[model samples]
Target: MGMAAVIYMILSFYISNKRLRYYYRFVSLLAAYGLIMSGTRGAMIVPLGGVAMFILLNKNTRYIVGGAICLLFIYVFFAQTHILDSNRQIHRMRTAFHPEKDASYLVRKANQKRLAEYMVHKPFGEGVGLAGMEGRRFSRRFTTDIPTDSHYVNIWVQFGIVGLCLHIAILLFVIGYSAYLIMFRIQNRELKGMLIAMNCGLWGIMLSAYGNNFFWQYPTGYIVYIFQTFLVLGKSYDKELAEQTKLEPI
Candidate 1:
């Protein structure tokens, strides 16, 4: 929700009406507060990833430099120092930066290795609903007992390398196509910003999905679908905006 609000806040700036724009920004900020309180490590990536992508897509050099500095400071605070360790939320978020030292991460890694060995001969995976807890419930013929903590891992174990690779290829294509459209095709500045913001949010969510199944879950799934719809509609939006601009009274 916070991630979605942050995207809305970014788009709200392009809104023409002063009152509506301010209301959107103010409400988004209020909603963004939930991001901190939730303490879900993966959720932290949404904004950070969005900012990074924004820097790349946006041509504003000054803002890019400023964003870079902020990102650097965040990295130092989260990965290098324990300055905010006293704060429970901050401490939990920091763990995401130090995967080697995180016990749960290590466990997940070990489980992945075990799964890899077990599924080495099965290139197409043991089959759907047959690799994790669901697999155990269905059958033990080739079930993996370790918990499927990450969606990627779950996909890999169930679909095998072939399936995983195909899935990733599709994601890469979507990201690449959207980026190309944003950079070269989209002409409306506001539309460009909105599209880039969505791209960034998705990039973050895709990466974070490795930690949890954000793609199939509530809100994120809907958000992803909606974003894709807009992404493919970029040309139409640009044309509409161009028409609207021409028709506006000078």
Candidate 2:
């Protein structure tokens, strides 16, 4: 849901098709409202990181500097004034940046420590379904009752350190290649902006993976794979369009 907003917001900013900009901007605001109401700490990073990347990549130093100043002002203003004093949702959103104030964060850290100790003996982990809730459901024999709060940790437990490295490498490669396309291969402003937004969104998801399993969970995972493929293919489409423009008899 938050990812949807991030995409719409990026489109609203990048798209020169004025006919569609207003609709996308409206949708982006609505999605952003929903994201704030939901109060998912990890998901919040999607918008923050994505927007920052979008602005920075625009190559307009004034906008980038102004955006940073605006963010700082907003943060300071909200923290100083308890405007949402009675709002549970806003309070929860505020706690996201303060991990020490979050009980769930403390518990997650404890569980991670336990998992680390457990992994000391079993280098390749107890195997699939042995480190998470899956283990409790399918193989009670290997279940150690430790919670797998992070997707990266889950991969480490199920497939070992090697698997974790490979997973991270793949994500990094996608981000790096997309950046290359945006910087060198892509000439179309709209296409480049879309790819930049995708790259930022992916980076946010990767960062959030450390705190939650949203990256591999359900529809989000499906969307991630789709966006990844779309960005890669977008570069080729840009080249074809350029060649067509050249060949056209104007």
| TM-score to native of every candidate shown | 0.89, 0.90
lDDT of each: 0.79, 0.76
5-35: candidate 2 lDDT, tens digit per residue: 7678677767998979989889888988998
**Which residue pairs in candidate 2 collide?**
129-135
Error of 2 at 41 (Å): 1.9
* Residue-level lDDT for 140 in candidate 2: 67
How much is the lDDT of residue 38 in candidate 2? 77
Model 2 scores a TM of 0.90
Error of 2 at 79 (Å): 5.5
Error of 1 at 25 (Å): 3.4
Using lDDT as the measure, the top candidate is 1
Best by TM-score: 2
